[model samples]
Target: MDLRHLLAHEVAAGIIATGIEGAYDSVSCSTAGNYPSMGVSQWEGGRGDNLLSWIDGGRKFIGRTYSDIVNSGELDELRAALDSEQGRAAQLEILAADCLDYVDALMPYLNDSKCVIYAAMWCPTSTNVVRVFVRNRKSWGYDVNNLSALADVFADEYYKAAAVGAMYRQGYSNRAYNTYNYLVTHEIAWELLDA
Candidate 1:
């Protein structure tokens, strides 16, 4: 199967086409990207994004919180570019920025940085909070067209969460990178084929 076309256009679009109407069609977007321990964020749209919306309260909170990281003296340059991507890409990028920021916020709660004093002592990497803010800024790019394409990124979060859990238990990661790498390859294929 052309996973790239499946992701970049057809299947991804199918998820949205069915999802926005509340018809409940979706694929298990992996929630990670290119790394085994990178963590996840929801990126499906149309129907898939709708599914995310069904369970995305936390995601919304993160977007606002990431903005706080930039605003609350954590870091600088947290502004969402309202006019960066062209057409649908702009919209997709906006959604991605929101979810990335939220997932970045989720990492700390998962890591329990509340007790790490170094988290509070350093410029960055000292705590999950600072780390997420930086990560989100870099992660949330401004060029995706179909917002549903976010499934590519979302899978990473789910995978990483699995990996971290596995690491703690038996020291074996969840192999999150596989799905991420697949999606990355898929997206690249999409750009070529769709073009």
Candidate 2:
């Protein structure tokens, strides 16, 4: 029941929901552009120096949580233990001793500008997008200038395609955003003891 696993599942759900891989594949990671991002969060590397910054943000989480273990100057010992026969148990013990409940630690991350934008981009329901926007404003310490307009744009695109009966017939298309929302609010939320 480590928070990391639960959040991992939640991130996986977001990945499957967003078709972000498609977006990533289409955009060049090396060039600054408007599309193609990294991971489920879709942190757009195309904008400014954000590509590497996005990666560093994710790494910062690990670094913050395990700084003690990392900074103890015992990497050689840790590596030895990891290579030993009882590596699994030893590794778990080490990790448990060093890491906090990452799920609780993950809330601030969820409200990150990149994550908020991704949610606003991919969340099928306007309500959830609004919730994300509010969290970004109130809890995440973001100014959130034009997110309402952005959310409106997302909604318009969703309804327009739906009205045309475009991707609805397939059932497993981008409408999977519905399943994504359900899983995040239900399964992933339950795992986090939030539901």
Candidate 3:
């Protein structure tokens, strides 16, 4: 894989982390749903367990459900574990790996740097949605090879989805729009792949 590709993934993930996770040490429980979520990507449930396990070989938060931790007032302990230097490093490593995996999955359908970054940003929440969008671009009257058009279409579709209360509230439209604007303003395409 291109080093630039990895950098693109990192940059996209950082943007998403800033919006959603707040900080690497941030943690939330049953805010969106019934499960505990933590770290940059907000890994939940089993994924949350996996993150904790990675931090200390499962010594801190393993074999405990969300309720178990909450009822026992262990959430602060969980936060402390995640706030450690080792925990921060684990979060970055896992997030990077996940982003790289998303990029690889998106490559066969969309190779544009902007589109790939957008897809990566969206994939963590709705993988099938983004994948289907890319796969069905042609049937949707979009030229799959037109990178710029594809990027616009992806952002527009994301905006519509956000408005529909499917993934997020209407306010989430700002995320899609702002993400696209950030990419364009930064000229990330030229900076990353020279496209």
- Tell me, by lDDT, which candidate is best: 3
lDDT per residue (tens digit) for residues 1-195 in model 2: 654444444544444445543322122232344332332233343321233233322322222212343465543443343334453333233222222232233345454332333343343233343344445444545443343433333333444433546454444234434433443354334424332
Better of 1 and 3 by TM-score: 3
Candidate 3 residue lDDT tens string, 1-195: 475456545554545544644466666664656667776778877778788888873356765666777888887888888878888788777777777767776777765666667666667766666677677775677865564575566555664543464555434556656666665666443454533
Q: How much does candidate 3 score in TM-score?
A: 0.73
The per-prediction CA RMSD against the true structure, in angstroms, equals 18.3, 14.3, 3.9
Q: Which stretches of candidate 3 lie over 4 Å from their true place?
A: 1-8, 30-35, 143-155, 159-169, 184-195
Determine the backbone clash count of candidate 2: 0
lDDT of all predictions: 0.29, 0.37, 0.65
Residue 183, candidate 1: Cα error in Å is 4.3
lDDT of 1 by residue, 18-83 (tens): 232122211132344221110111233342233223332223322233334444643222112111
* Per-model TM-score versus the true fold: 0.21, 0.28, 0.73
Model 2 regions lying over 4 Å from their true place = 1-13, 16-42, 45-48, 54-121, 124-157, 161-174, 177-191
